[model samples]
Target: MWQKLYEELQDQNFMIIAVAMDSRGIEAVRGPITKAKTTYTSLIDCDHVVSDLYNMVNVPQAVWINEEGRIVRPTEVSGAALSLNLKKMRKTREIYCNAIRDWVTNGEDSPHVYSDSEARAHLPSYTPDIALAHANFHLGQYLWNAGNRTEGESFMRKATDLNPNSWNFFRQMKNLGNRLGSGGPEYMARVRKRSKLGNEYYPLPDMAGMENLKK
Candidate 1:
């Protein structure tokens, strides 16, 4: 989805940097990325550095950074994805892509672009718990990558406890998922627990036109 949009606007000096926030890195994302054949810059964050930087808790979140290195739009729920072919999701993709095109064409003058103050207002700052959660997540990633699975799992559990609201933390902690495969027993159990609390893993913000996102 992003690739098609990028091609439409790339000639106008637009670029999209899609980052996958997963501890498993390339092994987790190889399938969708390979099948998409995306042309835009795509990278994997083995330690979720990008997620920490943006304080993004959900998958498919995005921020708009302009040529001058300004964040014209701070992080928020994004509709862009590889195939995102669900009917509701396709509508979301279209809405977000159209907004991106408008922003690229009009630059700072676009209504789709947030003003500096508005952008700053949307900027997510870390609280004590979130900060501590990220710290634990990083430790877990380091330990896991260093062949210390036992200790890594311990710290990953801590991170999950510290910030139960972060899907990035939960999903990434669960072996970064198989992408196309079923999430096994433990993962299913956790998802059921989270659902009981009325929070979808990919909870959409209360955007006017996206009421169907919960579906």
Candidate 2:
């Protein structure tokens, strides 16, 4: 998606500053990103600095900022062009690229231009719940790294409850459970449950598939 968007907007002077929300080092994503030759400016959020600032709850997430550095859009789904014919494409990031193209081609007419009130209205009342989940997920990461398995699992489970749609959160929950030797049977069950829910989210990548992402 970054590649497609970058290529489409390269000539239009629009910029996409991607901040990956991974705990891993940049080297982990460098190979995959390089393979795609993504030219957009990308940064690793190993410490999740940018993620916290933007209140990101998931991976493959993005914020659209204007030239003035004001956030034109918050952590919303990146717009990708819809392809009626490509229903079978797995893990399509091109949706974002398509959105970038439409914005460049149509300017204010693009769906990106929502007023503050308009944008706020689009948010579910459970947004704060999801935001809190994002925070707990980060806290879980910290606890896990600090060798507090019990506490980490507790936090991740909270995140999953707050936002069942976040497979990334559940994946972390699963990992934390596995490391603690208590998340196996239940973890497998939860993974399957979330996978079914995630299929509706489109471009559904399995827990293992997206676990390799590095910020």
Give the top-scoring candidate (lDDT): 1
Per-residue lDDT over 102-169 for candidate 1, one digit per residue giving the tens place of the 0 to 100 score: 89999989876887787877787778999899999999878977889889878978998998877777
Residue-level lDDT of model 2, residues 1-215, one tens digit each, is: 56665675688868777776555457747877778777788777655666556654455666656667655556654432123435323224444455556766776677755567765664434578877887887887788768887897788789878877765666546644454433467655765675576533333222222323211
Q: Give me the candidate number with maximum TM-score.
A: 1
Off by over 4 Å in 2: 47-55, 79-96, 124-128, 175-215
lDDT of 2 at 141: 71
Residue 46 accuracy (lDDT) in model 2: 57
The superposed Cα distance between candidate 1 and the true structure at residue 16, in angstroms, equals 0.7
Provide C-alpha RMSD values for all models, in order.
Answer: 3.3, 7.7
lDDT, candidate 2, residue 176? 42
